[model samples]
Target: MKPTDTQRLLRRMFDAAIAAAQPALCVPPLLPPAPKGRLVVIGAGKASAAMARAVEQHWPGPLSGLVVTRYGYAVPCERIEIVEAAHPVPDAAGEKAAARLLQTVQGLGADDLVLCLISGGGSALLPLPLPGLTLADLQALNQALLASGASITEMNCVRRHLSAIQGGRLAAACHPARVLNLLLSDVPGDDPIDIASGPTVPDPTTCADALAILRRYRIRVPPTALAWLESGDGESLKPGDLRLPLIDTHFIATPQRALEAAAAVARQAGLHAHILGDAIEGEARDVAKALAGIALQTVRRGQPFQSPCVLLSGGETTVTLKGQGRGGRNVEFLLALAVALRGEPGIHALAGDTDGVDGQEEIAGALIGPDTLDRAWALGLNPRERLDANDGHGFFEALGDAVITGPTLTNVNDFRAIVIDGPPTEAP
Candidate 1:
C-alpha cells in the first residue's frame, strides 16, 4: 500500500504548477507604481481575493476595494473586502459584489488608479448582465455553455456581450482614471480579454461573433437575450473605444509559466521533461486518448522521447456533458487515458486543475498508475463505463485516487504529467 516514486513525483509536479501561479508569488513583483490619488482596487474570479491581498501587502498608497472569489477560495485582507460567490455559475452574491466593484471606482480623478485583479472564472463571478437580461437568464445560459463543450474563448466571447461590467466596461467606468488590470490568465493563448471575460480590457469579440458562437453550439437563449445581441445592445467595449487608452494590463501568471515550473521539477528529479504544449485544448477524452498514444510510443519504441522522461502539458480542456455522473474535465481526461493505456507498464500519469477544483467539484482531479485499471476492476469499478457515463469524478473517488487540494486560491486550468520509465526489468 506504499505509494510509488512516480506517484510522489506526480504530486510534486502538481504542487509546483500550483505554486507557480499563486497570487502572492506572481502578483507582487509586477505591481505597478502607485497613483498620485487614491488607489481603488476591484476584481472578480477565483484568484481575485488572493490577488487583492497581494496588492494590499505591496501597495504603499491609501487603498480600498472589493473582490469576488468563488465560495471557499477567499483570503483575508485588511484594506480590500473579499466576497465569496458561486463560480461556473453566477449567483446573486457575485452580481452584488460586481456592482460594488464598479461603484468603488466611480468619481476617481485622472491621477487616480483602479487596480483590477482578474483571473479565471471571473465571467461567472462577475455576472452583471445587461439590461433586459435577468440573472435567471444568465444562469440558464451559463449552465448551457458549461454543458455545451464550448471552448473557453467561445464561452467568454458570449459572456462579454451579455455582461454590463465585463469586456472593458469596467475600464470605461474608471473613465479619466488610469486602470491597471493585473490578469492571471486561465484561458488558452493567455488572452487578457478572455480572462474572466476581460472586465477591465477591451473586447475584440463582437456581439455578432457571440451570436455566431451561440448558434454554432446551439445554446438556447431567451428571446430578450437574442434581441439584445442582435441589436448590439450587449456589445462590449471595442478596441477603438476612447476609454481603453488609459487602461494597462499585465499577465502576471499564465498556464505556460505553470507548465515550465513543473518541467523544472521533473528535471530536478532526474527525468527529462518534454513539454508537449502549454495551450493544448480539445475534448477531454479525445485529448486523453492522444496523449496516451504518445506515451505508449515513448515507452514501446522510445520514438518521440527516450525512457525516463516526463511529459508535461497545461491548458483547459472541455467536456460535453451528456451522461448523468459527476464529471470534471481533468478527471475525464485522466480516466480516458487510463482506459486507453490499459495497465501499460512503466507509465504513470496525473492530471488536475491548478485551482484545486475541477468541474464544480472540490476534488482537483486524479492520478493513474500502471495498475490503475486493474485496481479499479478489482474494486468493482468499470473504467470504460465510468468514462462513457462521464463519471470521471465518481470513478476516481471510488479508487481513493482523487487529488483533493482544496482552494489553492489560483487558477491555471489543467496540468497533466506523464512519466515513462523503461520496460519493467525482470524481478527476482
Candidate 2:
C-alpha cells in the first residue's frame, strides 16, 4: 500500500524503535560467562525464544534448555526448545511449558549455568499456578487486572505472589546452580522484578502488597489465590534468600534505549528530536491529551521545542475499560490525540507497541494527521463517541489507517512519535 509521508515517517520511527532492541544485536554482549558444568537455559516472554537463539549462537559449549514465549513468537534454536504459549492469559500450553521449564532447571550442580531470558509478557506466558489454584483462576485474575487500569507494577506484584514460577521461584528452583538472568525492560522505572514478574530475580514486593493492590483495583481474585496471599503462604522468594545469591541479572534492552534509537533516526532526517520521557505512565487518553498539547504548542507557539522536530516517548499506558469495543492502548491514544488536536495541520503522530501487537489485537496501532477526524466523521463515525466507547480499533480500521506488523518477536513496551513540521511553508 502507498503510504502518506506522515504514515511513512511514523512507521520509520516505530521500526527504528523495534530495531534497537533486537535480540541478536543486544544479547551477544550481555552473555554471561559459561559455567564449568552443563549449561541449562530457561526463559519466558515474547522475546525469550529469540534470545535463546542468540545464546545458542554465542556460547562455546553445548547447551540444553527450554523457554516459553507468546504464541506465534517462537524462533528456531539448535539445542534449546522454544515452547509457544498464550499471552496476557494463562493457558494449558503455558501451564505445561512452565512445568517443563522447571524440570529443565532442576538437578543443576553448583557449577552449572542456568540462563534465564526474560522480557515482557513472561508473567502470563509462564503460568504455573500456585497449589490449589487452577489455570482458570489465573486467567480470571489476569482479565480483571487488564480491565482495572492498574499499572504494570501493581499487576505484576499480584502475579508474582500468586504464581509458583514467578517472583523468583524459578530461580530458586535452580538452588545451587548459578543463574544468569538476561532481561529486557518493558515496565516503567525498569524494575527488574517487574519485568515478566521477575521469575529469576529476587522479589521485593510482599504478599500483603499484592492483596492491597488487588483491592485498590477492586479485582476479585480467585478465593484460593486470595486466601494464599492473605496468609503469606503464596509469598515469593525474599531479597536475601540463599537460593538467589548466585543469581546475576542484566537489563539488555530498555524503552529508554528504544526511544533514543528513534531519536537518532529523527536527527538524521534533519529534525530536532526531543525525548519527553522513556517512562511516562498514565491513562492512554490522559497521556494523549498531554502529547497533543505539546505538539500543538510546538506548532502554534514554538515552546518546549521548535518546529521541524519530533517528540519521542515510551511507556505502557493503561486502559480502563468502559466499553465493549476492541481497543488497543496505542490506538486509543492516537484517537484521543486526534480528537484533542481538532485536525491541526503540521502535526502528525503514531503510537505502537514494540512487540507489534497493541493490547490483545494483532494490529500494532494507528497513525493520525490533520485529516484523521475528518475522515472518521465522513465515515459516519463520531470521534468522541468512539473514544468513549474505547473503539479506536474500529475507528481506524474503517479509515484504513491501522498499522499491522504481525509479530515483532521482541517487546520493550510502547513506542510513540509526534512529528511537528512547524509553520506552513516548511511543513512536511
Candidate 3:
C-alpha cells in the first residue's frame, strides 16, 4: 500500500473512533426515564456541554440546569446553561459555575431529578476548592500533578479530596433528589470514581489516600491544605453516606467502545484488525518502545500476527515533563515510536486524542511513516534531540505530520493505529 493510502486509512479509523463516542449518538439511548417532577441537569468536562445538549434534544419534559466545559467546546443548548472554562487547569469561571451547580440542586425533594453529565477534564472544570483552600492552590496542585507522571486514578484521588463539588459532594447536595450520572469515560478502566473524579458517584478513597499520593509524587500543597487532609477535614463522601441521594451511574462512551469502532473501520477496508488492549497505561515514550517492538516483530517475522494487519489500542498515557518544549502524550508517543522504528519500511502509524486537543496545543496528535525520520534528517532535524527535549509537537509540526482536528466534542482518551503492510508478493 502507498503511504498516502496508509495515512488515509489511519485517519478514517480515528474519525470512526471519535464519531462512535459522540454524545448525540451515545447519550440519548442510555438516558434514564424522565423524572416525575423537576429534571435539573448539572455537569463538568470537555464533553459535558455536548452531553447536556443531547439531553435537551431527547427529553420529553422541560429541564433546566448548568454544565461547565472547556473553552471552545460548548455546543448550542437552550434550556441547560453551558459555561466555558479553562481545562487541565481551573479558573474563576469554573469556580463560579461549580458554586452555582451546587446551588442549582439544593432544596430538591425525592420527586426531582438531578441529571449529572460527567466526562474527562471535568476534574479540572469543576474546581470548587474546600472552604480553607483557594483557586490558586488548586491551580498549583493541578500543574504539579500533570508533571508528576502519576496515573489518572492517583491524580484524581487527590483532586476528589481537595474539591467541594467532586467526590460525591454534588450528589450529596441533591438531598432527596434522584441523581442519574451519565459519564463519558476517558480514563483507563472506565472506573466511575475516576471519571471527573466522581462528582456524582461515591468515592471509596479517603483523605489519607490522597495525602499518600501527594507524598509519593512529592507534590507540595499549602499548610492549610495539608492540615485539612491530615485532620480528615477535607474527606470526600464515602459510599453509604446518608447525605448522598439515590444515584444511578451509566457510561455512555468508553475507550474500549471507541477502539471497537475503529476496528470495524479497518475490517471494512479488508484489513485484519487486532485489538491489543483497551486500557494500556504507562509513560508515553515507554509505551512507544513497547509498541515499536511488537510492530517490528510483526513486520520482520509475522510471529504473533500476520502482515497486512492493523494493531489498535486505546488508553490514556502520561509524560514526565523534563524539557521546555511543547508536548502531548499522543505526539510524544508517535515521536518515540518513530525513533524506535528507525525508518523501518512497510510500517506506518498514527496516535491521537479523540478530543482533538493533545496537551495544551490545538493539534490532535501526529502521523508517522517509514520516511518520517528520513524527512526529518533531510531538514536537519535530530529526532533524538527532539524527543529528549519533549518537543514532539514542534518536531511533528515542522515535518507537516501533525494531525489537527479542532473540537471533536468528545473524549475517549488516546487512539493508536499501527499499520503494517506486507510485501507486494504476500499482500492480501
Candidate 4:
C-alpha cells in the first residue's frame, strides 16, 4: 500500500476502536429499570460526564446527581450535574465533587437507585482522601506513583485505601439504595476495583497490600497517612461487607471490545487482522521491543501469519519517567517501536490512547513507517537520544507525525497496530 494509504488505514482502525467504546453507544442498553424511588447518579473519570449524559438521555424516570470528568471532557447533561476536574492528579474541584457525591447518596431508601458511572482516570478525579490525609498528600503520592512505573492495579490499590470514598465506601454510604454501576474499562484485565478504584464496589485488596506497594516503590507517605495505614483505619470496604447496598456492576466498554472493533476495520480493508491480546502490560519500551520482534518475524518468514496483515493490541503501559522531556506512554511506545524497526521495509505502525490524550499532552500519539528514521536523520534529530529522554512527543511533533484527536470522550486504554505487507511481485 502507499504511505498515505497506510496512515489513513491505521487512523480508520483507531477511529473505529474509539467509536465502539463511546458512552452513547455503550451505556443506554445496559441501564437498569427505573426505580420506584429516587434515581441518583454519581461518577468520576475522563468518560463519566459523557456516561452521565447517556443516562439522562435514556432514563424514563427522574434522575439527578453529579459526575466529575477531566477538564474539556464534559458533555451537556441537564439533570445530572457535570463537573470538570484535573485528571492523573487530584485537585480542589475533584475533592469537593467527591465529597458531594458521597452526600448525594446518603439518606436514600432501598427503593432508590444510584447509578454510578466509572471509568479510567476516575481514581484521580475522585480524590477524597481518608480522614487525616490531605489532598496534597494524594497529589504527591499520585505523582510519585506515576513516575514509579507502578501498575494501574497497584496505584489504584493505594488509592482505594487512602480515599474516603473509593473501594466499597461509596456503595456502603448508600446503605439502603440499590447501586447500578456502569464502568468503562481502561485498565488491563478490566478489574472493577482498579476502575476508578472501585468506588461502588468492594475491594479485594487490603491496607497491608497498599502499604507493601508503597514500600516496594519506595514512595514515602505523610506521617499521618502512615499511621492510618498501620492502624488499619484506612482499610477499604471489602467483599461481603454488610454495609454495602444492593450493587450491580456492568462493564459497558473494554479493551477487548475496542480491539475487536479495530480488527473489523482492518478486515474490511482486505487485511488479515490478528488480535494479539487486550490486557498486555509492561514497560513502554519493553513492550515495543517485544512487538517489534513479532512484526519483524511476520515480515521475514510469515510464520505467525501471512503478510498484508494488521497486528492489533490494547492495554495500558507504564513509563518510568527518568527524563525531563514531555512523556506519554503511548508516544514512548511508538518511538521505541520505530527505533526497533530501524526503517524495515513494508512495515508501518501506530500507537495511541483511545481517550485522545497521551500522558500530559493533548496529542493522542504518533505514526511510524519505513522512512521514519531516515526522515529524522534528514532533520538532524537523534531518535535514540529523544527516546532516552522520554521525549517521544517532541520527536514525533517535530516530524509532523503526531496524531491529534481532541477529547474523544472515552477511554478503553491504548490501541496499537502494526501493518506488514508482502514483498512486491516481480514484473511479469
- Can you give the TM-score per candidate against the true fold? 0.97, 0.97, 0.97, 0.98
Q: Global CA lDDT of candidate 2, please?
A: 0.89
lDDT of 1 by residue, 208-260 (tens): 99999999999989998999899998888888798764978888899999999
lDDT of 4 at 236: 88
- The digit string of per-residue lDDT tens for model 3 on 1-428 reads 23498899999999999999999999989877877889999998999999999999998888899999999999999999999999888999999999999999989999998888998999999999998899999999999999889999999999999999999899999989999888999999999999999989999999999999999999999998999899999999989999888998889999999999999999998888999998999999999999999888888887578878999998989999999889799999999999999999999999999999999899999899999999999999999999988999999989999999999999999999999986433322
Off by over 4 Å in 1: 423-428
lDDT of each: 0.89, 0.89, 0.92, 0.92
RMSD of each: 2.2, 1.9, 1.9, 2.2
Cα deviation of 360 in candidate 4 (Å)?
0.8
RMSD of 3: 1.9
Give the Cα-based TM-score of candidate 2 against the true structure: 0.97
Model 4 local distance difference test score: 0.92
Give the alpha carbon lDDT tens digit for every residue of 1-428 in model 4: 23489899999999999999999999999988788999899998999988998888888778899999999999998999999999887899999999999888889998999888998999999899988889999999999999999999899998988899998999999989899899999999999999999999999898899999999999999999898788999898878889988889999999999999999999999999999999989999999999999888888877577879999999889999999889999999999999999988999999999999999899999999999999999999999999999999999999999999999999999999999976433221
Per-residue lDDT of 341 in model 2: 97
